[model samples]
Target chain A: MNGPIIDITDLSKFYGKARGIEHINLEIGEGEIFGFIGPNGAGKSTTIRILMNMIFPTGGSARIMGMDVIRDTKKIKTQVGYIPSDASAYSSMDVHEFLSYCIRFYQIQNGEQRISDLSELFELDLNRQIADLSLGNRKKVSIVQSLLHNPKLLILDEPTTGLDPLMQSVFFDLLRSENKNGMTIFFSSHILSEVQMLCKRVAIIKEGKIIQLEDIDNMRKKQLKKVSVELADHVNIKSFSIHGIENVITGPGNMLSFMYSGNINDLVGFLSGKEIINLMIEEPSLDEIFLHYYRS
Target chain B: MNKNLFLKEIRRNSVSLMIWMIVITLLIVVTMSFYRTFLENQSKIVGMLSLIPKGALQFKGISNFNDLMSVLGFYAANNVIYMMVLGSIFSIVLSSNILLKEEYDKTAEYLLTRPVTRSEIFISKLAVLSINVFILNLVTALAGFICMELVMKTPFSIGAFLILSIYTLLLNILFGAIGLFLSTLIKRAKPITTFSIGLVLIFYFIYTLSKITEGAAKMGYLSPFRFASVDATNPAYTIDLWHLAYFIGISLFLTGLSYRLYKRKDIYT
Candidate 1:
């Protein structure tokens, strides 16, 4: 409540000789939609599991809600909800039974009403057996269960896996509304566009380490910009030299594009004499920004 | 312990426990039903049994033909396989899977993320396992008692019958402890049901082999089944304190060790 809602310091986890995550340090403040992006086996789940106290970290520590993750797991979990990547529920239980079981773990009034509201929003049938539901329907059940207790902080790992586009829209809208009501969300996913769409700040992890941490606005406006140009005549582009110009590519008809990180004034001054035919500079897609980081 | 988890688990295993109870009870009923007919032809059956090897008779736990003259002895000798071996099998299967099922079924994520401590989860499941084993033993033992009551030509020692039932329960509980201990040591999330059953069968074989072979008699000590005395026909039939310590001591030790292991176990699902 005083400092950051989620604080991780020098955390490391190793699976025997293999690395799970190493020397990872991160802090996420209260009431923020923090994105954790990483490819498969990139230790996104490992960090989240340690935060949720599902697995113990081999070194360092993590704290949530200003308490140690391991020592205060039960207390911390009282206000923390999680939606795991896999949508596997107890196949023996129907939708209502599974959700009721989940909500009963927490001491909350109006649990049945909460379940009903969430199920209705997701269009989930409460009587259908989990084993009989499709993967997407199972995801809807998972989402409904996580929200039933009104946890202060929600951690979702690839939560949109089997969701249809319509359902995803509804889910995002719900998340937006929840965040506005003071819930901190740690959204972990490999999809950059989704992270870009929902998160104000993001940490990109690669190969068991954090590669980039930045605000979405600063990452786009304050730094990198995608610039492409066409000239009337082909020229030796190798002759051009400017700072922060990277990943340059050439196309037919003297078309060229590259990421520009230098001052816009300098870029324009350098190109003012050339490229008289056409010029365009715009914010890069999250994919291009990620490519820039990966390459760098 | 978490009461919600305990009740849910009990409900989940109810069907399996009931089926095991019925199967073992049915075996006892059918075996006891043959008691009266066997008594009518005692002399002929005794002569027929004389042709069988002494080792084979001992394997069925019938060291003396006169023991079969009593209904309790007949029931103990014939139903040892169903009550002790099969019951132990059931106990092990249930205990082994009770905790591991959450992982293999991929439901552990939901369970562990709840506002419950690992100890509460472990103890809740342990309570369910203990209660289920106790119920199974109680039902089958009562069935044995009732069958003896129905078929008895003369009243047998109630003390001896009670001792046999306690020994069977102790044996089943010990297997349950072993199952719990082994499950915590598994590194991956997969069903160990086959391996668990095979372990019971192999131990039973070692026990039976040791019973028949004089040289392998000492080897019987290696099997938990050896500590469970099935000699109900002996006039001095009683629960041996040493055997009692063996059952209780190993069970408590394994259960305690499993608790420690599970508390530190890195759950992967």
Candidate 2:
């Protein structure tokens, strides 16, 4: 409460010789929806697993609400909710039974009401067995269980894999309302659009390291740009080589496309002398930005 | 131990427990039902048994032809494999899967993320495992007792019967501990039911092999079954203090080791 809601300092996890996450430091303040974006196997789940104490860190420490994630895991979990990337629940149990079982872990008033409310919001069939539900429905069940406790911190790992667009919108609105009610969230996903839509601040991890950490708006407002040029005469990709240019590729018929993060003036001056049939420069989508980070 | 987890586990395993109880009880009853015919044709059966290889008979725990003269002896020789070996298979299978099922089922995310420590979860499941093993032993022992009472022409030694029952219980519990310890040693989430059952059978094979092979008698020490005295007709048959210590010591050691390993285990799903 006094400092950050979640504080991870130089946290590292290694599965023997294989790298998981290395020297990762992060601080998420209270009431913030913090996004952790990475491609598959980039250590998003590894970091979350360590924070949840489902797996141990090879070195360093992670704390939630100023309590050690390892030593104080039980206490930390009391106030934290987690939605795993995989939406596997007890298939033998119906939706109501599984949700009820989960809610009993926390000491809360009107747990039944909470279950009902959340179930209604997700349009989950209370009588449906988990195995009988579709993938999207199973995801809805996962989301409902995580919120039953009204935890101060909610840690979600790829929380929206199978939800429809409508459900995703409803889920996001619910998350906004919860954030307004003073819950800090750690949302991990490979999807950049969702992160861009919801998170205020984000950390971009690549190859087991945090490559970039910045405010969502600041990240977009940065000098990063998607540039494409069509030349009447064929231009060698070597000529387009400049600092901050990544993922350069030559398209059909004398066309070149790449991400350019260098100064705008320098990019324009470099292109001014070229016989340009057409030139296009615009802000890159978050996916493109993420690709740029990964390429860099 | 968390009461919620313990209760939930108990409820989850109740059906399996009941099925095991029924199967073992049926096994004991059906085996004991043949006692009357065995007694009636004693001389002819002895001649027939003598024609069979001595090592094969010993493998069935028949040390002597006279050991099957008494009803309880007949039960012990015929039913030890079912009650002890099969019961052990049941115990280990239950214990091994009780904790590991959550991992393979991918429900550990819900469990580990709850407001409970790994210690509490492990202890709770251990409690369920112990209770399950105890109930299986109690039910099967009672069924054996009833069958002996109903079928015996001569009364058997109740003391010897009780001692055999306790040995069976101890053996089953030791297997449960072994299963728990095995589950913790696994780095990934996968069902080891087949492997756990194989371990029990392999141990039984070792015990039987040692019994039949004169030169391999010393190898019985390696099998928990060797420590379980099942010869109910032996006048001096009692629960050996050394054997009791071996069962209790090994069980406690494995259980403690399992608990420690699980506490630090990186549970994956």
Cα lDDT of model 1 by residue, A1-296, tens digit: 79999999999999999999999999999999999998889899999999988889999999998899999999999999899999999999999999999988989999999999999999999999999999999999989988989989999999999999999999999999999999999999988778889999999998899999999886655478899888888878786668889988898788888999878999899888885587999878756767888887
- Provide i-RMS per model in Å: 0.6, 0.6
TM-score of each: 0.93, 0.94
Q: lDDT tens string, model 1, B162-242?
A: 899999999999999999999999989899999989999999999888987989989989999888877888887789999
Worst 10 residues of 2 chain A by lDDT: A286-295
Candidate 2, residue A253: lDDT: 98
Q: What tens-digit string does per-residue lDDT give for candidate 2 at B164-196?
A: 899999999999999999999999999999999
Compute the interface RMSD for candidate 1.
Answer: 0.6
lDDT of 1 at B193: 91
CA lDDT of B53 in candidate 1? Answer: 75
- In candidate 2 the C-alpha lDDT for residue A182 amounts to 95
Model 2 per-residue lDDT tens digits across residues A1-296: 69999999999999999999999999999999999998899899999999999999999999899999989999999999999999999998899999988988889999999999999999999999999999999999999999999999999999999999999999999999999999998999988779989999999998899999989988655568889999899777887777878888889999999888877888888888888999999877756777776666
Task: Report lDDT (Cα) of residue A81, candidate 1.
Answer: 87
What's the CA error at residue B269 for candidate 2, in Å? Answer: 0.7
